[model samples]
Target chain A: MATILVADDFHENRDVLCRMLRLVGHSTISAANGQEALDMAQEHRPDLILMDLSMPIVDGWKATAILKTTSDLRHIPIIAVTGHVTPDEINRAISAGCADYLAKPVDFERLLGKVASLLGDTQRPPFLSS
Target chain B: MKLSIRTKLLAALGLDLALMLILGSFALNQMSAMNEEATFVAAQTIPSIDTVNTINDILLSYRNLQVEYIINVASADKLRIEGEMHHLEEDMAKAFITYDHFQLDENERATFEQTRAGWEQFVTATHTQFIPSNRDSNTGNVHPSFSRLAPLYDNLLSHVRQIKQQSQQRATTALGRVRAAYDASRLVILSETTLTIVVSAVIGLTLSSNIARRIRKLRDATMAIAGGDLNQTVALRGSDELQLLANNFNLMVASLRQQHLLLAQRNTELSESLETQRKLMSDLVQRKQAEEAADRARATAEAASQAKSMFLATMSHELRTPLNAILGYVQLLHLEAQIRGNTDMLPDLERIRSAGKHLLTIISNILDFSKIEQGKMNLEIDTFEISSVANEVIGIFSPLAHSRGIDLTLICPPEIGLMRSDAGKVRQVLFNLLSNAVKFTERGHITLTISHEYHSGKAWIFFSVADTGIGINPEQMGRLFQAFSQVHHNTFHHYGGTGLGLALSRQLCQMLGGDITVESETGKGSVFSVCLPADIGTVQATRQTHVLHTNGNLPRHIPGSVPSLTPGEETAVVASPTSMTQRDA
Candidate 1:
């Protein structure tokens, strides 16, 4: 299982994201905001960070930019989570050092598939949606 | 006379000549009368006076010679008596000739005739009765006859004296008459000459003042006007050229007054025009500035419009994020509930999921349209397995078909292999079609078919989704792809949706160089097809070469004559017609 950090401002949203990741056989951690997410990310050094870009206290873009600048946290892959799925918003997330983009509310299957691929884990089940 | 100017002048000159002719004629007549008087004195009166004086002298001498003969008859006296006798006869004859020579009046002729008779009787007695009868010494007879001879001499002398007196008196009276006539003629000629002179002077002065002076005044008036004094008037009078000239000058003055008024008005107009021109100049400047400001305002408006369009295209994300999370977790919970076999709550959970998903799709369609407007929606063109895309889309409607007790079928051509086109867009459009087919059809069947097409040197992959259920009416088909429009308003109630799926699907298909067409009728089956032009770059070039190879004929991969795909490079997903998603035609 891959270690995943779930960052979101809404308590219910964070809880749901962590539970989904756990059900998908991923090790989960939770943060209330970008600051907590950034602190947790440095401490845990997770395999992937699910960053909610609209959070308070150093939003996803700033936190991502800071994490990319920090050598210790730079190798930790980030997947920008946003309600804004426009190309410019996606490009903004990627340009700020996110490894990929996921528009919210995230598709469970699509989210898991992207997370499995980015973690480079061979043990995850293939998405058999069709 | 009421004469013209020229006639007046000529008449004055003619008057002078006429005065001269009258004076000349009058003077000539008076002088001729004086000449006649002078000729009468020189030719008749003076000669008659001289003849009378000679008669008196001859009568005295003849009477004295008779007295000497009466005194003594001496031989010398007798001889003197005979000679005196002859001389007395000669003197009497001379007096008669003098009377005849004068053109005498009746008184002078009567006096001459009495004188002539008296002389003839005295001469007869002196020569015959008183003198010797025969040549003897007549002394004796002389004394006796002395009385008779004396009486005869006295009578002869008296007649001669009477004739001389009458002639002298006639001559004096004639001379007095000539002197009176000469004085009267001289008085008349001198007065006529004075009258002529006075009349000529008066006429000359009148003409000079009336004609010449008045004309001069008219000339002066004309010159005054020529010298630019229009107010000057001519001093001319009478019914002549001068008066007419004065009248004309007055008319000219009136015309000049009218002209002066007109000139004043024109000057005022010119001043007003200058004012108007000045106003126009300022107006033009203001207009030009206003135009420039308008141009600047237009430019600013255009820039603001562009900014607004950009902002509106990429609208806010607040409405979607939370909603997305809600739908996402709901789907997860449903999946969890389904796995746990909580069959009793399945329907309720499914309802929540369906509603949430519908709302999310509506939001997503709006966002997708905005992205399209901003030109941010572009297909990723690539080679993709055409049947696999069709199979994947048909698989989405399979569960719906089973739930509704309808057959779901896929008829994919074996040769519908890897086509160079946007696979994701083709799947998206195919998903929309399959979803609509499954949603509309209540009972019979939903069929998905794929065809490989080559036409006009282009390749196409067409996927048709046909459904046998409550079909769309012809009128409803018209606005099938209009955003936010639902064919047959009741479709919205019967089939729950945001009504943006077909429009968004059509837009997505068009973006991928394809179009979706629908065929339907009321109470019959409907067939919806998605036709996409496959990546024509390499295909077109190969087809052109093939056409050339075939000598300008069609390339081989036609619809009825489709070719099979080559093996090994791709996995074709042409399922069996009777697979789990299949239904008989």
Candidate 2:
């Protein structure tokens, strides 16, 4: 299992994200804001970061830019989570340093799929529950 | 003479008068002395000589009468001899009295007195001694008496002769004194005349050299001033009225020179300003006409734009609101299908969402064009990385191009940097261009070049999209940017576009203070170049402009005098053979 950081300002959204990761058999650490996410990711050195765009106390763009520039943190893959996406904002996120992105309310299948691929997990798993 | 003609003439006259006075007085003194001498000779010398000669002749006549009486016998004859003697005596007395009328010397007076006494003695002897009655009446006796009377007469004659000689000597001496006085007066007159002539000549020369010369110089200076040569001035000579006149002339000329210079300069300035004003007036007239034309156009545009704004306002709220609701419900259904683990409904929900999004895109494009036409579109300006915008536009179309078997690439030369403009508008335009490129391009490559040019202090960023695909013909290209116009009747059907992309893109480019142009040919390729105005405060112009292709090969050089590109610009190639259909993101 790969370690992943879930960053969100909303408690429910963070819990849901963390729970989804745990259910996929991946270990998860949760943060309430972008700064907390950066601190925790540096402490734990997670394999991937799921960064929320809107957050208080150092937003996702700045935190992502900070992390992408750090030589040690540069190795981690990041996926942006946002409610709306425009070409301008997309370019901003990409330039500031996100590797991939997903639109929310989170599509767990796509989210899990992107994480699994970044972690190099070749074993396929059923993403949807009946 | 106070350095004046009047004074000099007076001086000459005065000198002449003085010379005349000297000559006249000398002649006057000489004439007075000559008159004295002539009067003395006439009154004394000649009269004294005549008295002396009269006494001498009277004495001789008395002696001869005495001799006659002595020889006579009658008493009456003797008596007549006595009377004749008395008459001789009386005549001698009158001659002695004449001596008193001359300027006589003492010697001449003494001589005259002795002559008168001697004449009286001779007369008595003749009357008494020679004719005595008691004497014997013999003739021999009369001879002795006559001899005695003759001796006395001879003595008186000798005395008279001595007086005449002395008087004549006095007259000669007076003549010599008059001759000396005449010679002295002549010498004085001759010398004074010579002196006056020399003085007059010298005064004339002085007048010519000083006053006359100064006057000539003043005339020359005045003439020069009249000829517009203000530099000339009179050189003053003597300190006099003429000099004062020269000084005043110099002052007049100096002031005139200043006025003349000022007037000439003012005249030149006036003409120059008049010419400038004339040119400016013509330019203003032309400008007024142009402004009138522009106002007319603007008024018509504003009227049409008002109508367009009303339409766009109705469409945006009416259309976008419902479209958003539709997309929202489709997205909710998509999420619902995932949550329920309904894999069968997921694709349908996704299709619904995709269709909604397509419709949204068409609606958005139409709205954008309507906003532009209405002049309601405004740029929200900010600073953003142009390269990143370009990259993002390219990135969004890369998968589509890859799916179509097209090679996609982007290049932002290093010389370019951040731009302060409406990034969203740029992204929108680039999105339209790249999407159109990918949508039309089926094979070969798609290139998006980002370069900048600096000209006349303004920087322009050029984003060009060239594609090798189903190209447009020359006939269809003319209507490319018309709203909702398609290249062919079936182009919209085949390409699946609202055909508003290029139209909106061109208008959007104009919104960002630039323009969009296109080049295309049938069965070949097409290029859409969107030029954007950029603030060069933080951007450097690129040295070479190049188009990015998947193989790092530049697109064909444009049809103009544009210089060739450098070999060292950076380009990102996406030869990723990804497969994407309407089903995938």
Best by DockQ: 1
Question: Residue-wise lDDT of candidate 2 within B303-348, one digit each (tens)?
Answer: 7666665575556435543454455456555655777778799878
- Ten-residue segment with the worst summed lDDT in candidate 1 chain B? B543-552
lDDT of 1 at B7: 77
Reference-based lDDT, residue B49, model 1: 79
Which residue pairs collide in model 1, if any?
A105-B324, B408-B581
Q: Candidate 1: which docking quality band?
A: acceptable
Off by over 4 Å in 1: A125-130, B1-316, B323-355, B372-388, B409-423, B448-464, B509-517, B529-585
* Model 1 Cα lDDT, one tens digit per residue, B294-376: 98997786566446435544453666666766876786777677678777877887888787776766667667655654456
User: Which runs in model 2 stand beyond 4 Å of their true positions?
Assistant: A1-130, B1-3, B71-73, B131-142, B149-152, B219-228, B268-276, B279-585
- What is the TM-score of each predicted model, taking all chains together? 0.52, 0.39
Per-residue lDDT of candidate 1, residues A1-130 (tens digit): 8899999887777777887788867899989888998899889999899998988988999999999999888998899888777777888999999999887777877888788888886455542342
RMSD (CA, Å), candidate 1 to true, equals 14.4
